[model samples]
Target: MMYAAGLAGVAVTMLLILIRVLLGPTVYDRILGINLFGTKTVLVIALLAFLGGRTDYLDLALTYALINFIGTVAVLKFMQYGDLGWAGDVEDDSDV
Candidate 1:
């Protein structure tokens, strides 16, 4: 019962963070909310696995963490400059 309550609380917190992400005043704030949501998700997954005696599920959490980090970096770079180029190394592929 306690474990369920904890996971439910984490889910509620995640929902609040989602709202913040939607109504953020700035790109950075939204990114921060997104990062927080990802972190909470990882923690909840780990907690559930531990409660269930399923340690192997941790590998899934690790994969999600790596993907989340990559996505956050990409989003930060795009928000800073509105482009996905190689950090100010834009290339023109037209020969006129």
Candidate 2:
């Protein structure tokens, strides 16, 4: 029962994020929507693990959350620099 409720919540969040993503005024707004969706997914995963009686799944959820954070950071950096290889004011030894 609890698990069902969690799934419902996740569905609701996804719908809301989709709406925001569609109506977003800027790229940043859409990126925010995507970030929110990722967070909601992590919660849903944790809830599913609890429902399935698998504590180990919670660890997996955490791992995914970390990955999501790293991915988001990378995306934001790329967006700001217009390239993933940006190294602001820093020169690599190989460049010398």
Q: Which candidate number maximizes TM-score? A: 2
TM-score of 1: 0.75
Look at candidate 1 and give me any clashing residue pairs: none
Per-residue lDDT of 1-96 in model 2, one digit per residue for the tens?
978897898989899998998999898998899888888888888988988889789987898788888778888988878888877655545663
Which stretch of 10 consecutive residues in model 2 shows the poorest summed lDDT? 87-96
**How do the predictions measure up, each by TM-score?**
0.75, 0.80
lDDT of 1 at 71: 85
Could you give the C-alpha RMSD of every candidate to the true structure, in order shown? 7.0, 5.4
lDDT assessment of candidate 2 = 0.86
* Weakest 10 consecutive residues of candidate 1 by summed lDDT: 86-95
Scored against the true structure, residue 31 in model 1 reaches a CA lDDT of 89
